[model samples]
Target chain A: MNLKKPLTAETISLDLKGDSKDAILAEMVDLLVASGHIRDREAVLKAVLEREKRMSTGMQNGIAIPHGKTDSVDCLVAALGIKRGGVDFGALDGQPSNIFVMTVSPDSRTGPHIQFLAEISRPLNDAAVRAKLLAATSPDEVLHLLIG
Target chain B: MSGPAELHPLVQFVFQLGVLIVLTRVGGYWLRRWFRLPGVLGELIVGMLIGPYALGRFAWPGLGHLFGLAPGGGAVTPELHAVATFASIVLLFLSGLETDLSAFLRYSVVGTVVGIGGVVFSFYLGAGCAIWFGLASGWLDPTALFLGAIATATSVGISARILSERRKMASPEGVTILAAAVFDDVLGIIVLAIVVGMVRAAGDGQGIAWADILLIAGKAFGFWIGATAIGLLLARRFSRILKYFQSPEAIAALALGCALLLAGLSEMVGLAMIIGAYIMGLSLSRTDLVQVIQKEVEGLHNVLVPVFFATMGMMVDFGAVQAVLKVGVVYSLLAVASKVLGCGLPALFCGFNRHGAVRVGVGMLPRGEVALIVAGIGLTSGAIGQDVFGIAILMTLVTTLLGPMLLAGSFENPASGLRKPEDAAKTESKEIVLSFPSPDMADFMRARIVRAFRQEEFYVYRLAPDTPTYHIRKDEMFFTLECEGDTVVLRVTAQYEALARLVVVEEMLALRSMLHMAQENVNIETMEHELVAGLFSDDGEDGP
Candidate 1:
């Protein structure tokens, strides 16, 4: 139920350089790889992209939750990215998505991934919180805004 | 007679079969559309017309007696008759597969007693007629036993059609009639098995005693019950094995193969082959493969079932029928009365009133296909003569024609058939309706809900091809989801209401998340293009 356990400052990307949906997803996965949370980068990326093919994870209000299940991660790992100018991620409302919360969990497990998604979705649902998180300059600041 | 030096029997059979199929199809269709009667009646009439006693007796210059009897005085060529017999096996096999085990259990208490009553009454009455008219020596006579066995079958299809047409399918009487009909079929088959065993025993030159009769009945009943029990237990495993074939047609063909194997085994064990075929079907009835197998084998069913009926018709000796006209009439009347009194009387004690009883009784009157099949077997085995077979057909035609009329009339009163009327209210299921803004939205929601349930590991399948209805089942839980235009309806029992609501809530949450994603991903370029196009249109020039 705690978002702080999975969404760490090390895994937060304040200024995402990726200009496209696939690029942004790769940028986010790179953060998780950098933090040493994922064992196999390709496996995690393949899972996330495969999940995206089923349905666009780009939600409303400048938020998107791209998630996948893969055994490359022993537990649930997440990375948060902010594309301030926004990128087209096939959001439901036909608007660009600025914030992305990507989670990769072990395929054998289920509960922690759904719990993290639900927790992250709650704070992102608030317009004011999304705006503050989008404006945050530092990774630590982004983490505090999301977790707190 | 000299033409073509007497064409080969195989060639003659091929010609006869081609003619039979063409005439029967045309005749069946005409009867169904013109008279609103069952197609089987038309098939029978057509068969009789083209049979040896009529048009078949005449010889053509080249094809002498194209539809005539076989050289040894059989009604039809042995090749054609073999196909007809195969058709009967397929018919019973499909019947067994289509049996509604849940419904059968649901109405077991009332249905069991009513079924038993109908069988007991009809058997005795029919056999008594045979004996009184000098067709048999006593109750133990093979002809008497065959007559009784034939009488016990009540064609559920005939009654079900009538009840469905009247929109009384959910009525107490309707449910009871259907449930009892299921039992009637099972019991009728059992009776046939017992009779076949006895007849075979008698044929072996054994002096029939009371003990021997009991032993034969036990062996027949035991084989059916044992096979069905074991088959049900192994059905799921058997289905899994069949899945290895990976093709629907292969699975269906293999299933029919198993049916045939079991049928032959049944004969080895001294019971009727149809019983084994029925057992094989009943075993697989509870598995997920029922619909798949049914859809795959439907082509085979349509091509063969009519031939079986028509062949039975061809075997009807009109000369023998006329010789026993008095007995046939009396027997037909007794057949109708026995079903009404036997089946109806039991319904009154269950929950139905006199009117309801009459409906149930009338519904059970039609002996239809099963009776004909039994009589055909009797004649083929020489347990009964042509005259008896002719009388059996007479009874089938009479009851089949009369059943629908009497069933329709019984419902004319527009009164509740239940004794208290409140009992009808008690069995009504709780329905939850979810209304959408449009039919498209409803369809989308219905599909998503079904997908969610599938993800939850519920076995989901469409109930019928033409309807937007689905049946969901997992473990002990069951629900029927139906989509009607802009509304989706879920019907469940009271105990499952909480579970149903939980599934709905989870689906709604998933939908909300999807909606959120759609809103967030909206493209700014497309919206701007639409706006620009609208603002700079030729019509906008006049407005400006």
Candidate 2:
């Protein structure tokens, strides 16, 4: 599944403040809310976290996709946070996860949500893209590097 | 990458791990497919093949460097050895977790009887063999006692893995074997303490003090009982303390930290690190955190256990093997016979039939890590000379190899119902839901919905994506991606759900952390407060 909507620069942050996965996830979920991407912060945070326990979304190459599908957001919503000194996301590779792609969707939409997840995952598979995303100075650079 | 001197410590560790994992997999597959032997046997062989005793002996350029040796690698470095030791600790920890405490308690009577029989018989028989067949007379008593103690040890990891692979973990014979093995470990350690203490006493020109002997044994048991009681009492509070943090690494770190702490403490009290780690596992075995600890520690175990096994393989000195070859055969045979007769008769008397008793006896034959440690201690302490130490090592290697063969054969005799069908169909299903439920309604409904499912029949997880895709267990039903969309599709397939409930608890903690971040003032100490008390209590009060 490929994501139809483009991730805007407004919802992306280069400086994530949390030292742990939960704290980072909270920061990311807060970004999505502050950016008007999702409405109920607690509900979305709970849903994203509930999904987290099933398994970590931390992928190889220091990327973590912490996502949830709930009615807290009307349509597809996504946010990104980057911490220079990575937080332990309990990745299989046992490396700290630096790049976080947070997504929240309406509970009714399965196809587009799956597509969005796949789309985020696909670009991350490229080492060059991953490196570029990590090295990018701002969210604009990250968006261009990821979605370009 | 060019030289061992230039490679980063992290890089060296990664390379070593990569080599070990690849070789263990390939070698283990070949052994299982062709010889029908345990994978561990193959790992040991592969380890020897690539170790300093063999390929590295020839000064294979890159191989030596990769294993953390000089260009022409001589021995594994202290750093690498430390890694193996860490692996050993993790291995013992995992063995402890896999232990069924209730079953251990249930079979304690028979297990203790069988264990004592095996220990006494093996000790006396092995000591008699060592003393009678040996030319030296002056140091006979201590040497024989040390050798006897070495024989009494049973490798819980080796036997447990073999039984698990055979799918006999739940069988009566397996339970008895495990119980006996546990008892054997405690008994073996005590025997070692007495022998070592006696040797030290004689070296100092003093007779063995009865008071000192009693004290040492008391310390061993006291440490175990005390640690278990204290650890269990504190485990729930520790779990609650951990819930305050959202890092998945926190739980594993805490668990491993505790294991190491106890291991160090045990060593400080003159007990083995393995004993300490095992005790730590037992202490947490009944707690809410056992599942959580198991979930986080599995990854560490996979990496470290192989290192321990492979390093053990590397310890086999070919010269020792050659020198002791003739005596080794006799000692090995004596070792096996002693365990079989010693452990077997007790099992038979304890309501097990002839075949079950034989199986139990065969199971105890592998003197893996424990034997090596005992031999090493004896050699270093001068209780046994190099040649005798060589003989002990040879005896350990032979017994280790012979164990799986006899164990497999005993299982194949078909007289007992212990052997489960290898290809039994599993009834569990893994459900993947691609639904477009309202994001608002999804969170409100999840806890309520999942709570309605009987906890006994269905184990559910809200966040389970932390597991590697390959490791995504089949039996677990996990909910993910709560988003609003156009349609909902549910797909169900059979899989394992062993980690199902553990995942839910982990998710609840994660959510708790999130809530703490959202509300800076609320002090949520447990899942009940944030999950059940805060959210679920007012479920119907809000509608999307």
Candidate 3:
């Protein structure tokens, strides 16, 4: 349960140019497609969009984690991006957000998902942890800060 | 701070909560079974039985320890109260979220009529009873009158539950009832404010004058508008910030912040925080990220809302009610009669006819959390006597149990004569696009539609707002707009239609008017089919 997962240094591209959420989401999806993790971009996109109808995973600290689990993946999958200026994510705090960390897993793996969520998220609640993670340039560095 | 810290605070708190949860469930469940009221009512009874006022007051040693009872001023804290208030706001916002605004607007006319008429009539009846019975009880007319005035409200939660049980919530009548209940709540709260003002003036030992009452009424109305104006502006600006950050943490913080500010302002203005919460909900209702905000806010209710309802129950004096069960029974009946006759009469004259009248009476019958809230406020103030408190509780109890049974019993036999529309959702599929009929509204929507699309095949015929027949006892704006490729037809009330057509003519005559501005390629016309017009345009972007 306490296995230290590898933290790959990820660059979250935040495009503040678009006023619409769909536009922002499309940019993130394109990044995932380019990364070669997602198969049928449209299908995955629809699945993620549908899951959004269930509940938003967006938390505090200018972040949006729009995630939906599917049976297509056996391993953990995530996409990170940063909106340069920030776009309205419909957050309760009424702040524009630029950071996104979407996670996808097999529907059967609720335990790992919830556990990881609480672990990774504990830091997001603190401003200092976010600054460290967002500023980390390498995956190893990100992991060191997250798991240390 | 003084409690045993041997165990972890988390463990102790959990234990306290566990006891409360179990006690609340048992008492609430049993009360629901016997009293047939909302589970909250039972929870309240049990809380009263266990709270400082009852079991703690009596100090039943073993049971009190097991149930986690404590003496007055020793158990609950301001922090808990704040938590409860927050939960209440979340619950209310959820309630507002559950309301289907589009569906509600369809019968806005009916809802407004029944709501206002029922409240007005019910209020007077309660006041009259307070005067008559109150005078007999040696109270002055004005105080008694205010007391009765406080009774005219129908808490929407109970009525919504009953409607859902009967499966009539989606039915036209049910929709009307639900909408009416929503407005009734808004109106009732305002009335409560007025009464509070009157009470305060009297408490200050000032002479209760008609002018004083009028001033209070004026202030209450003005106060609501003032709060809403400021809240709406702040909320809109805050909503803009959500665009800058999509992070869950930031989003949640923004929502909590706005909720707190609005809630604080509402309290400062002497209004319920829920009112402020509701106003905030309304202001943000139309945003794109509404669903997003909703997802996050749901977490708030899971914990705090139950606490709020539990707190309401905790405020009850169960033993006292039991001691005066006879008076409780009697007062409960009086409360019912006052509500029915008072609300029913106006509904009948307002075109409900007999079944309509009875429907109005039944719809207004279910006493809700509002009654409990009133009693709580009164008891805390100590301005009301034990008898009055007992009567208030009795009123809440009787009304709670009576409404569902009577409505169900009446509507059971379809022929039993309730204008109760068949089922809650019983509606023949009819799609109607509602537009308030006025040249201003018509022209406004028309302009927006024209700007959104420059379709050459656009035609808008003139239709005035809907003015139902004089004898119909209805007041609302209704019109039909038809849009063909280039030609549009509108069907409106003749009088308003004529005015609208003349206005359109005047606009067309002016060079700056839409007619002159209409590009040869752009069909700026009102169409005959409103449904088609709506399907193709942007929300708020394409107007009428």
Candidate 4:
């Protein structure tokens, strides 16, 4: 898995806007499309939602990782969104989720998808890393904070 | 009757009704809103406070003049008493209507045994106490026998009120309690007759009438069985007649009139009037008019039940506090304990686990009007003194108070292994849509689809998501939670249909716990029921 490939300023939205989980997810999906990582927008959105159905992606520390494997995407892709006013994702801890990391990968691949999921989750689990990501004001600042 | 001018019974009744209604409603509201006590308890407390035995004494100069002291130590005027009696019948009628006859029939065997157990055990303890007291203090044997009869009584109304408030009246324990109480009434009537007859014979120095005992038993059984059978058979046809009157009010009136008619019939057949009212209610419970009838009667229940409870409170003197303490406390303890073990043990023997048995026992503890009637009969016949009557009253009050409390506890921590799931889906203001991959790799998942989706607490979300572009299964009649392609969209229903759904939804959650378990590979058993059948499909057919 290439951790550096998807960590671009264009794929990160520091000031995401959405009142609900779907809106937040949509905002992040828009970021991935705008960044030229995917071709079929509808297929990827459906795939992301399909992942959400299996279980809520919302984890502890105000974060959610909504990801899916689908034929619509040619390569592994990622997008991040931060909505300060959290949306309820039916979080396990019952807290509103503010940080969302949406991932789309090709259906033929298994190794990179698993490895990419691990790479994304490792730094997010740390309290200081999460604090820095949450404090970042711009997409550039968020990328620097995330990949640093 | 002794007042300067006998206030026209109507005028006196109006004032009495006004006071009773205000005190009970205000007091019930206060307790329910602030103190969180049961509404019925509030009514009972208000009745006690303002009754002639307490505050009514101070108001005797003016208010008491208007409300005449319960002439001759009995509570309520002849006019008000008549209304309260009607209220009692209405209350029982509602109870009967709510009784699920099909559920009652299912548990009839266990319910009957528990009822018999409750009657026999309570009778022995009560009669033994009376015998011991009689042997030591020169109390009459006839009085002891009468007291024994009183001990066999169980107040279904009190338990029914508390259970109905909690919505547990439809539960297994609730059905068992109702059935047992019905049996208790029948058995109590027979026991009371035989004992009362024996007392009468001994008092007159005449031999016991064998014919009278048989006749009394026959009458109680004949009335209950005959009325219930006839009522059930005629219920649907009677409901059809009510279709001529389209209004809900007309239907309610017809229902209440039937209840009143049955109550009168019950009295004629040597049975409690409420027994007939209850049977009448049960007969009409399955009719199409039941929902409308229930809604109509609810207003009447709110007004009338409070009056019945409050009047019951007014009957308590409390001035006999010291004498009641001397005789009432020990007897009340014995009475409560006997019913608990008696009803509870038989319930367990009949296959109810411990929790269900405890509920049955607690439900039977309250004695209410039935026990009071027995004591009243004993008192009027000169078979028992006023002190024993006071003891019985005190016992009734204590048991009534304790019953709702214990019954509430028994239901809260039911013996069922599963906990009551929170109605999270129901409480959610916004609809939530969940999407998942349709299980295509596993053939086993295909076979279990219908059973897995079969109606339970949770239902599949049928509607397409608000997003217009992403649509699937729009024309399908039944919402199978399946969408186009590999993905399926499942709408969350509040019902927790399976324990496995909880585990599946908390996938990341288990990761934390899995890390704690570190070395051991976790076995996934949730898909076993679906997958195991597929693995054995190729094997030769086994025993049927």
Candidate 5:
């Protein structure tokens, strides 16, 4: 509901390393837990993993958004990251994904789930926004690009 | 508790369906991206997760009770089924409608043989594996074997999608996989009949006999024959009637009505509704209706297929699968290996080199959702204990699970730009002739052909004059291709004009044509159906 929420450098800098999708999700989970936004990081990670074990959410446009909701996360949280070289998210289009918007919400509300999907999907609908995200110098630039 | 007028049915359906769709899309996208699994599998898995079996969501209060869930909580809803069923019909029909029928026509012989071999070999192997596992553990039953047979089906839609992506679909190897798959489908259907008959026999006192098997086959075949003959004749008439419906709404309503009616009739006859839908699609395939129907059907399926696939997830309890986890893993691996070894080895024997064999094997690996349908049949029949079908589902899980990687791997360094002219000619050649059992297709040969050859028109044959008196040169080689209703007969004379004159004509060779198919099938004029060919003079020209 709050589209104008301020994102700190710490909030924006997500863990993204390696072609392995799990490593990225793991880093993001650890970051969220360390930030104290989420309890039981393992539960959140398991939820994400199990959800993925259901299907791959790689949008197949050099974008992969791995997401999950669990009781372990209180308010809705999103970890936005960019992998310039792209990670193999196992997309149907056979293209590697570079942008990952990992979102976690409470176990119940489907609202946050759809909202997060929109936040990521809507930006992706814009070529310039995508270009900005890809061209940004740092995670701070990435956040500015996102908010801008 | 309110009156029907208080809550509009449309609003209710939308509300319920909205949840399923959003959940499915979000869940499917996330799971698929995270797990590196197929979208369909993800949809189904999430359906299970959010269904009553896991956490709870909106329930079809009626079916929730049927599923032993406490009232008013679950993922199962009637509104979803309506769309899901619609999608299933379109999905299967589109599969039938979209099939590269020409590939099957050209490579019918080798593909049929290889496909049959794959199906029979895999069925028995899976059965053997089932029996062995059962024996080692405790005991084996017919159910496990049945489950194995079901596992043997190639799930053509999945394989086709994968093959199309790799650009290997039209290659001899690709064509062979598809052909064999269609052949396997036929065999699978027959095998399904036998198994179902056996089950029926087990239930009642109906004895299993060659007579009865033949009778059942005959009935199924007869039903199809009768239906096809009626359908095609009607399809033509429908084409006539289709002219009356110029508006999109009119055509859509008509198509939906026809589809639903055919789907219903198919069930009354014990055939898979998809089979009927396929035949319906094939019938319409002959008319301009295919394009219109395809567009309409896909439009509908955009709303339908995700739900069907998602509902499948709701039905599968992957969390509770720990009991069958070990067997699932083992069978899944075997399923992958058997297709590789069983299908791959024979392709090698058929003069395809190792890469060709590997291509064939990899092409056959993705089983798609029909495998789950087979697993369902097994579980419901009590032929396979829940545990055994559970294992069968495991195999589907793996095969469907690995589609993306297998596809990516197959395309890694494709064969160096197809076979050479001479080598490619050997694999499968196309020809079209004017005369019945025409000799010396030389008259149809043209010397000094035009430049700018289209790749589809790669083999240009110029129709030149050649006969006893004309006596076109014997040494010249040519290739010919033809189509019914459509014609691309180019006769290009050899580099040597004198050599080009002679055309050794072979007698018309009818393929392993099934008499039943020919009898009931109507002759429709489709340019696409024309036979395309190339003629080579045996001395220079080869003729039988």
Candidate 6:
């Protein structure tokens, strides 16, 4: 399960324009729909928002992973966004979050979704990799940095 | 100029009740703390000490005899007796609610046979004692039948407590004893119904025959079976209806109202009121609402249950007991022997070895609330005199005290009670521990874990209010979750270990996300200011 298979360049945003957490999530969902990854836009958005309501996905170290499981998507699909200004996304360290990685997977499957999370989370833990991804100006650069 | 004014009967009765409650509570606490005996025994002893035949006979300056006998023969007045009767109904109702219907069904065959054997042996021996000692005219005499009925019930509470203390609750013998105790309660109620019916028949000058006895037994059994069937069928719908009330207190009150109504109906139909209460409770036992109802009504139970026991003690006449001391002692020995043989013999045939059989029998030896209730009924209804009632109390005291000691001693050998030694390994529980960085985090994770299980339709409730422990149950799967400081532990069997881990993993993931959310949303400056202001407030002077 290659992380690049689900997270493609078309689904990556180099500069996220959303000023808030919900706005950033909505913008990422739009990217997934535009890339023809998500069949039902509203269902995926609802699932993601519902999961966020239970607990914020804004993790420490300026990283956020907002994910949900729903039947709206046929398979695992992800969208990556970078907001340089760092919006307050309820991070554990009480700091603003800049990197947003949202994934929507089929509700019937669990293995690939977990594997995708584990693979994506590994590279984000490195300070150098995160710095390079945040500095990357193009969607292709961001995807390459994340997958590599 | 004038003699001290006579106190009104109602005022006198209220004074007596107040005194009785205070004395019983103090006595119960003293006995429990010092002797490690059940509080009920203390209440009984206190009642006897302060009863009309003892200190109560001494007249005070302003008041007459403190606990003077009522106009009738009983020690307590009609008003006190009425309250005691209500307390007994509550006792039976709670017992019904606490019954583990699933466990009862799981061990049904062996439990039923064991229960039947106990009732049969106890009844025969109990009745024979009365007849042999000239307390009754014949086998079917009211006193003899009452004695037999009184000996049939094994206090499930006492046995369960001892077994759990010994950590043998999962043993074959422990489960069998518990299952048999449930059967003992049901059968005891049925036997009481039969005895009441027969006694009433005899009072009406009807000729007693074998056919009449069968008909009476059939009627008693029919009523219990029919009521239980209808109650169980409607339990779920009844629980939903109760939920409509919303508040726990309101729901509990309404449920208790139903119990009282059913109890009254049972009395009207010639069976004991407790039988109706028990059936009502048994029906609701399977519903998730049991924990809520039990928690809400626990305060009322604590206040009233002791009153009932103390009242039973007050009813005991020492002079009468002294006259029948020899008879009571012999009768108590028979009671102990009958339960052991009756309950033990059936267990032997059901996969238990001799050691297991003896353990099961000894575990079932304690005769508690139900026996006292039956004896109380007999005394109140004039079916038995003070002497018979005294003998019943003697038997209860003897078995209750002896039961725990013998049961604890029986486990000293530490040998497998099961015929197949391999089965013993199945009783061991697999434990899973999850530690957090801080106690607060553990508490948060524990709450979420419990909520996760609840969402999956498990009936989750705290084991006790004072402890950070919970019982999670769904159908046959049961788990114990304990949260202490920075650690949370889940105890379950191997079969359910995967499920337990899955729940914890899902909850921890959720907690991780929640911590992130909290960090982003929470403003450190405002939170610190609020915390400092609240801690240093002037209103703190009145706080603990």
Candidate 3 falls in which docking quality class? incorrect
Please tell me what DockQ candidate 1 reaches: 0.03
- What are the lDDT figures for the candidates, one per model? 0.82, 0.66, 0.54, 0.66, 0.57, 0.82
Interface C-alpha root-mean-square deviation, candidates in order: 8.2, 11.1, 27.1, 15.0, 27.9, 8.9
lDDT of 2 by residue, A1-148 (tens): 2333537777889999999988998999888886676778999999998888767878678988888778878777888888998999988688999988887878754334533555565677778888887888987788777776
Separate clash counts for every candidate:
17, 51, 72, 1, 61, 2
After aligning candidate 3 to the native by TM-score, how far in Å is the CA of A99 from where it should be? 54
Top DockQ prediction, candidate number: 6
Q: Which parts of model 3 have CA positions greater than 4 angstroms off?
A: A1-148, B1-17, B25-37, B57-83, B93-106, B135-146, B230-236, B248-253, B288-290, B318-331, B346-353, B385-387, B416-544
**lDDT tens digits, residue span B382-447, model 3:** 445445565676677678778777766645644312244342122321222324345554455455
> Which stretches of model 4 miss by more than 4 angstroms?
A1-148, B1-8, B60-64, B70-74, B108-112, B123-211, B319-324, B351-360, B363-392, B404-544
What lDDT tens digits, residue by residue, belong to model 4 across residues B473-498? Answer: 11111122333344333322222122
What DockQ do you compute for every candidate structure? 0.03, 0.01, 0.01, 0.01, 0.00, 0.03
| lDDT preference between candidates 1 and 4, better one | 1
- Flag regions of model 6 displaced more than 4 Å: A1-148, B1-6, B60-62, B106-108, B205-207, B429-544
Candidate 2: count the clashes.
Answer: 51
Q: B320-397, model 2: which lDDT tens digit per residue?
A: 567757766787888999899999998878777788889899888988766766675565456676567667766776
Pairs in clash, predicted candidate 6: A90-B520, A91-B520
Cα lDDT tens digits, model 6, B1-544, are 1111255778877877888788889999998789877677899888888877777676656777667777665588888899999999988998888776765665458778999999999999999999999998898889999999999899866676676567565466775786688788888888998998788777765536766888888887888899999999999999999999899999899888899999999888888899999999999998888988999878888888888888999899999999999999999999999999999998899888899899999999999899999999999888999999999999999998999889988999988887876655654556788999999988988898887776555656664344576766554456777788999988765445555765676688777776777788668766766666646557885333
Better of 5 and 6 by lDDT: 6
- TM-score of model number 4: 0.53
Q: Please identify model 2 stretches exceeding 4 Å from their true place.
A: A1-148, B1-18, B62-74, B135-146, B156-172, B185-211, B246-248, B372-393, B411-413, B416-544
- lDDT tens readout by residue for model 5, B438-528: 3333222222111112111222221111111111111112233222222223232222211111111101111112333456566532322
